[model samples]
Target: MTEVFFYHLQSQPLEAALPTLVERSLERGWRAVVQMSSPERLSALDAHFWTFRDDSFLPHAPASEKGAADQPVLLTTDEQNLNGAAIRFLIDGALLPADSANYQRIVLMFDGNDDDAAAAARDQWKVAKAAGHTVTYWQQDPAGRWQQKA
Candidate 1:
């Protein structure tokens, strides 16, 4: 069964938090696909990855790249897993893919400050749970550390 994790962004923006998660996924030897809802968001994320930090950057490519499947982390606006990834990250109001179980894990990150985003996450949580996926919820602390809430 796929494990679905809901990350409620409160303390920091997605750009600040996402790189760490992607790095952690790479550490676990898991390829990751980050799905967004628009090309503009995808492009921004692609550029952000290259300079998210002063010293290092996550190795990634857009799904439209020539060797997208060879990238360790792929960014796109589509639900298709171009890379053979073990994890899929849904962000920027991206809906849960119909083939949610295709990946080992599905991470749904939503802005807690956004009423619509929070509401959407709740709906996704219910759907994932109903589908028999192990679901977990996480919220950030004041210091920007994630704490599992459910």
Candidate 2:
């Protein structure tokens, strides 16, 4: 069964947190696809990944780029998993795809400060649970560390 994780962003924004998660995914030898709600967000992330850190940048490419399947991390605004990733990261209000379970893990990150985002995460949580996936929820603490809440 797929393992679903819900990350509620409170102290840190998605931009501040995503790179670490993607890096960890890569360290685990897992390819990841980050699904965004819009092309603009995907574009922003594409640039951010290059300069997110002062010393190192995450190795990734947009799904439209050549050899997308060869990228360790793929950025996109579509439901298709062009990279055959082991994990999928859904952010910026991207809806969970019908074939979410196709991946080994599904990460749903939402802004905890936004009511709509929180509500959407709740709905997704219910759906994931109902679908029989192992679901867990994590919330950022005051210091920006994630603490499992449920």
Candidate 3:
């Protein structure tokens, strides 16, 4: 069975979540992929040795040098390339499909402020539930702790 984990990035930046997810995936020995829409943010991840491109799929490797095999693969889209090998794609709150078979699990991470984001999160939750996939919605407090409110 595939598992999907969704996290909202309203309280914290996606940068903060990346390392945590990578660490968790490594610990659990699970194959994981991450996708995002921000070029600047993607560049930042590239500096940290995360892979970014469209033609290739790279796994997350914390110890690899720049352009090494042991790096997290990241893909940047500009309307031309909308999707990559991402099992889960972290998108803006307003845009995401509620029902998707792209992967076994789908995670929705967003801030609580945006109304569209909230709506999408709820919709994704409903879809995942209906499809029998694991759905998780988390909110971060001022103290920087992720509390699973939903």
Each candidate structure's TM-score, on Cα atoms with residue i matched to residue i, is 0.98, 0.97, 0.59
- Candidate 3 per-residue lDDT, tens place, 4-89, comes to 55666656666565566555554554444444556665556656533333443235422223443233333342222122333444
Stretches of model 1 off by over 4 angstroms after superposition = none
Instruction: Please name the candidate that would achieve the greatest lDDT relative to the true structure.
Output: 1
Higher-scoring candidate on lDDT, 2 or 3 = 2
TM-score-sorted candidate list, best first: 1, 2, 3
Residues 1-150 of candidate 1: C-alpha lDDT, one tens digit per residue? 999999999999999999999999999999999999999999999999999999999999999989989999999998878889999999988988899988899999999999999999999999999999999999999989999999
Clashing pairs in 2: none
Question: How many steric clashes between backbone atoms does each model show?
Answer: 0, 0, 12
Residue ranges of candidate 3 with Cα displaced over 4 Å: 38-41, 48-89, 93-105
- On a 0 to 100 scale, what is the lDDT of residue 99 in model 3? 36
Any idea what lDDT model 1 has? 0.94
lDDT comparison, 1 vs 3, better candidate: 1
